[model samples]
Target: MKHALNNPYITRNFNPNNWMSDIPIIDSLSLAELVLPGAHNAGVDKKASYTALGISHWAACQNNSFYYQLTHGARALDLRLEYAVGGDGVGTFWFQHNGFRSSRSLESLIMSVIRFLDENPDEFIILDFHQLNPGNQRFDYKEFNRLLLTHLGNRLIPSTHVFLTLGQLKQASHARRVMVAAENHTELDSTYFCEYIEHEWSGIGTASVSELNVHITKVMKFPPGGSLPWSLSATSYNVAEGPVNIREHLDRWFDPALSDWVLNSNIINADFFETSNLVRHCRTANLIKANNH
Candidate 1:
């Protein structure tokens, strides 16, 4: 199962809690794969199946009523494929899959989006990377910067900014700021780069962004703890004017539906897959932010 993950940066054994336990933890990657019923599946009569399909479709649609209600009438989703590699492969996109069920669940959503981008390789999508944590003496900024430049740079169209959450970055680093790495490290200072979105895209010989009808997601939130969201910052591509204090507000921010995120023991974490009520709140908050913008 681990071999199936094609990501070079993340492998099976990338464990941060090695000292505490010996069990291998799966990477928190969003890979796309789904279990759609096959035509050969047992129990259904083919003649009746096709005849009843139209009614089934409507029934199913009605069953998933939350989709229309939540999206405010926007049914079909638009994906903004942001490629990660130069061959026009890895990237992110935005789509409206109705709700967080089946294919739209977080894991399935990630997988489907990537699959769409992978299959449509010629359409050089936009690309960008953001630092997940605050850059301080604590992180290996130099190495991460190098990796970004080598792997993800030049591929991401210009003016596509990467977000770095410096909410906890204090100027002083009296403690040791050792950036340990099993494989990679990078850092960049005073780095600001931009170019025409197409200049870099043309290198891949793909369809124009306009032709693809790619609609960018106005807001992308990478809440701390990487779950539904315990703490939220303006993690969008755009930065704000004043300072944002994530710790103070997010430390104990509570909602009851969050219990669904609880993982089993050291095996999982609170809001691990982000299914709890907290996720709903976060998505709502994100929509609000998008509207405000």
Candidate 2:
């Protein structure tokens, strides 16, 4: 019951979906203290139809679905929303990457997050809405607000509650477990959602594994300080690179860094998260930190 069939990518015999809930010690850690695995471009996945679009190789960062990412232990999701015209002549939000809108709607992905949270109540998640691009000059903030309030309701932790430990947040919400971080917002109130938490990236824009490794080393030596939580984007972008090629390089860098590099950041965001043992390492880190405390 704790595992799925053996897979070459995902680690076997672990409860990723309920990881936070399963580890009681994790509840004592604040969002700023715990190390978590995050999915970069969390909603972009490869399907046969998307592959036919010819951009799948470059566009897709994930080989699995959004729900699969959550189930596999991605606690933070980097989501970009695009307002696109649907077949019915109405505009709706879709998960987007590099100007390519996905076939999946943003609402569907949110619902899947809700479903996962409901099933595993103690597990918490951070939804980082980093960008909201509109197709036209005017975008409907009202509709977007309605979508969030209608679907997420009270499950969203208020922006003011960012400082709370997971146990404190759970008690504050009577057990609600999600924080919606929308950086650009007009109508949505801060009481229900927060701005995008700060994050740091290589700034090299496109980097090879060696370059990224150097960047991380420099940052950790002089990491920024603040009460707010931040993430380290452990990713490199290259249009010529596909998931497999990028992962092959990342695997070489990640395994060694898990024990040391992970200790420096609250969250470690990556592309193709399932292909590594990040979940296990993160859990181990949390346990050690808690025990030491």
Best by TM-score: 2
lDDT of 2 by residue, 102-211 (tens): 66677778788888887887888888887788854255677877898888877888778878888899888865678788765668777877767777888876776777
| lDDT for each residue of candidate 1 in 1-293, tens digit (9 for 90 to 100) | 00122333222332221211121121111000100001000111111122232332211111122122112211112111111222454322111111111112223323332443343321111121211232112443454445444543433222212221111111122121111111122335223232111111112222233321121111112112321111111111102211112222121232112321111000111111122232222222222222332
State the TM-score for model 2.
0.88
State the C-alpha lDDT per candidate. 0.21, 0.73
For model 2, give the RMSD to the true fold: 5.4
- lDDT (Cα) of model 1: 0.21
Tell me how far the alpha carbon of residue 229 in candidate 2 is from the true structure, in angstroms, after superposition: 2.1
RMSD vs true structure, all candidates: 23.4, 5.4
Model 1, stretches more than 4 Å misplaced?
1-142, 155-189, 192-273
**Top-lDDT structure, candidate number:** 2
Candidate 2 clashes: the total is: 0
